[model samples]
Target: MLLNQVPVFIFLIILSICEAKQLLDEEFGTDDVTSGLCDDFFHGTPWPLPHDSKGRGLARLCQNQIEDGKEGRIVFATMFSTTERIPVYTANTVVLHRDGKEHPRPGSKYWYRVSLALCSSDDHTFDPIESMIGHAEKHEMEQCRKFQAVTEDYTHNGLNLDRGHLSPNSINEQDLEKQLGTFTLTNAAPQFADFNREVWRVYECVAQHTILDYVPGEKVYIITGTHGVALDVNNNPWWMNGDDTDMDKNPVKIPGVYWKAFCYPGNKTHSAWGYAIVQKNENVYRKPDYNEYITLKEFNTRGIITAPFGPSCMDASFGVFSKVFENWDEYIDTKCPSYTKKKREEL
Candidate 1:
């Protein structure tokens, strides 16, 4: 019996060593391992379900009526149909705010964009429904008319910015209904054509590909929005195109920067690996790179995200996959040559 017990002890010791090594790997740098996990950030708070004054949680193309003090509110749009009835797309909607005609600032905790999910499995294939596109346009027109009647604000047309969809159509390519839902003007915001088509487009593709490759079967939650005062080429805040007197005639506001955050919850090993990326909405073309990724702590510190992203659905350790790049040292050297040289000399 003692001899048999010795083998069990040996096995336990080996297992402990392996676990320790993995932890060390995460601590130092390991792209595949989960490095950060902050589960207590939410403090038992529940996810905010989308709703409006009328208690209508889900509306196709309607805008939520903002209360006098309330700057913004979220309203659900559509859900992705999955085989398991998992309801993978709750809180998958837009956050509307009131402010300017070219750029809008959502009040604290309000998303000036949309958040949603996409699920794909080996057996499932997503395809867009061409017919639904027309239907979606009709809904937008009707909703715009209703908005005009209630607020008398100008419609979302005749702007220099493109009607960029917060929840992009490409994300829901697997489901026709979800794809169509993205077309609603309510789900869009004014965006510079160059920024939208160039910088932002690349980032979106990288984000989508990262999830698909890392967690093939699980659902990925993507929260996207805009923030900050729009900037002119000279880096000054670009307010309404014309004087404030005519501002009421147009209410759309352009954004200075666009942001996206994503989380893959099924990776139990690295459940805290949430990430957020921000790109300037300008014409200067820069390809999406890993350096753009920042930790959730850094994101909050920079004032990019002010809301409490908690209750563990999004976790606390949200940020970039820090260990993915092999030349981090070299990259830093190039950016800060003096600093790198100083550190190396001291070492």
Candidate 2:
């Protein structure tokens, strides 16, 4: 199907073009954060299900919406359908709140109306999306329920496979071993190899070498998934270790609970700099800090944050560049990606 035939395509193209123009205008020192994604990105709340006309709603009690770079610290969202499935529209939303700053908090048992487009259903090969409709809850269960977790090899419906991050391998060992402990299978994702290999690496450097001071015992907890979460049994949204109080016999050890944080830099006391959970498929990692992003100046937005990590590093470690970049253009222009440069002794 040609783009000229679809109105949604027009929307994406128009937005892309506009974004391109905007980027061209301010080529150097881009502070613009296209923002985030699934699972850990939408924790502590009930995710909306697929609707009749609105596709699927992602509004939850604890979701931090993205922002429009052109608009000072405002949440932003987009609706698009793969060239294959036109009716199955995918609504991607992201928010850039100032950790330690004032902003809206997406807590548990809350209400939100972010995005819900009627997704298209025109499945075809290379149909504008290499990624398929990801599984929601059970997606990550392939290994979550299995003890002695398989760290290296894991898949979610076996789709857009990339550099699946299981532990703090050679890629993100930021000087601290326990902090790098997040590199466990419980902390992996289905990100593109280029993203994990090239771009996200830059963040590791900044997080380890650049941001020196941090609160001790600070840790990052992460979870990622598709569809609505059960808030039980599943391991994509929340993976708090040892939290089965209401049940008998501990079936899991990963932390399936929300940690703490403060607001980011720029904004008021709304959001925080704690676990910056990011994901591609059934995998999620607790981003201790979006360091590479700090230079972009994310301190002047939003207001408020109230969590344990409360926006500070919880004896945490490591960092990753955003994965919003879908293709080469993204890898080049936006991300200043680095790669695993660890020596033998470093490991």
Candidate 3:
């Protein structure tokens, strides 16, 4: 009986090892088999390649919902010094809060960018992910090719708007690939220099620190995006100079407001918190007002932007843990008073 049981135990061990290898392959795209596994794992089928109508390979998250009326097609970025390959993981690994899209009318391209990754406290050094920018470049090149427009035409040159990152690099510092993934132009929107450098910049730092402090060593998802119309220095809506016929002449849409929301999936106490800042993309130089901080629900309700998580994620009570830090003002005052003080001094 003992001899018979030994064979069964050995078989079980072998099976476990095989499964472990398969999982690793699926996660890393080690080989063709792993590539197929990733496709099946994400799409649950192998019929259609993950390319969009433009023949660009969409990211796994974007591919999963191509049929769901998402606007812009997906484009995967290659690692800077490594071979070209798409990343694969379970949905819980990185949540694509919104898919990229090209909005109709005004011909203004509105790139919807937001995603989240779970962080491990073991490593905290934030490294730049150059691939994120590569993917964005690839996507922009595809768009340029479609219109027979030179790559320079797609640049926001002479527009006085800076290429702002919707999903900032600081949040995913733990993972090199994901950090690089944030560099893509697909994740960027045109932003006013003053707003981007002053107001939004400070909020980003506060949000990141809040996450690291509150959910230390836990799984946290950060979702961020931009919306609304861009304004000129005179507080007037800005549009491309030419008629809206060709992609070359089209102006990159500038968001009137930028928002960020973060969630701690591991937290049973509260779900998520979010805030929005309104910057008309003008020439004004001032720090963002911390008084603008609002609950995730209010931000969405007022802005008409969809919540990163479904509506259920919003806690109306504005509970203690809802905003990560108990007092937004206090946190800004204590943690980094310099951000606020410097703004006042400039004024």
Per-residue lDDT tens digits for candidate 1, residues 1-347, read 99989999999999998999776444322212221121111222222221111211112222222334332322332222121111112224221122212222223222222221111122212121111212113334433332211112223433446656677765554444454445444455557666776667766655554444455545555666655557666766664332356544434445567777565444456555667777776655565466788655565555543432553534456323454345544543443233224557899
TM-score of model 2 vs. true structure: 0.26
Q: What tens-digit string does per-residue lDDT give for candidate 3 at 1-347?
A: 99989999999999998999776445433321323322321212221221111121223232111222333323222111011111211121232212222122221222322131101121211121111122123444443323111224335556556656665655555544444444444455556676776667778767666655555555544455544456666777654333355544544445566656544444567544434444444545665465666665565565333344444445433343445444766776665454447778799
Q: Largest TM-score belongs to which candidate?
A: 3
* Per-residue lDDT value at 92 in model 2: 18
For residue 224, what is the lDDT in candidate 2? 23
Which scores better on lDDT, 2 or 3? Answer: 3
Provide the clash count, candidate 1. 12
Clashing pairs in 3: 72-101, 72-102, 129-180, 132-180, 132-183, 132-184, 133-183, 133-184
Candidate 3's TM-score: 0.51
What does the lDDT read for residue 50 in candidate 1? 18
Ranking by TM-score: 3, 1, 2
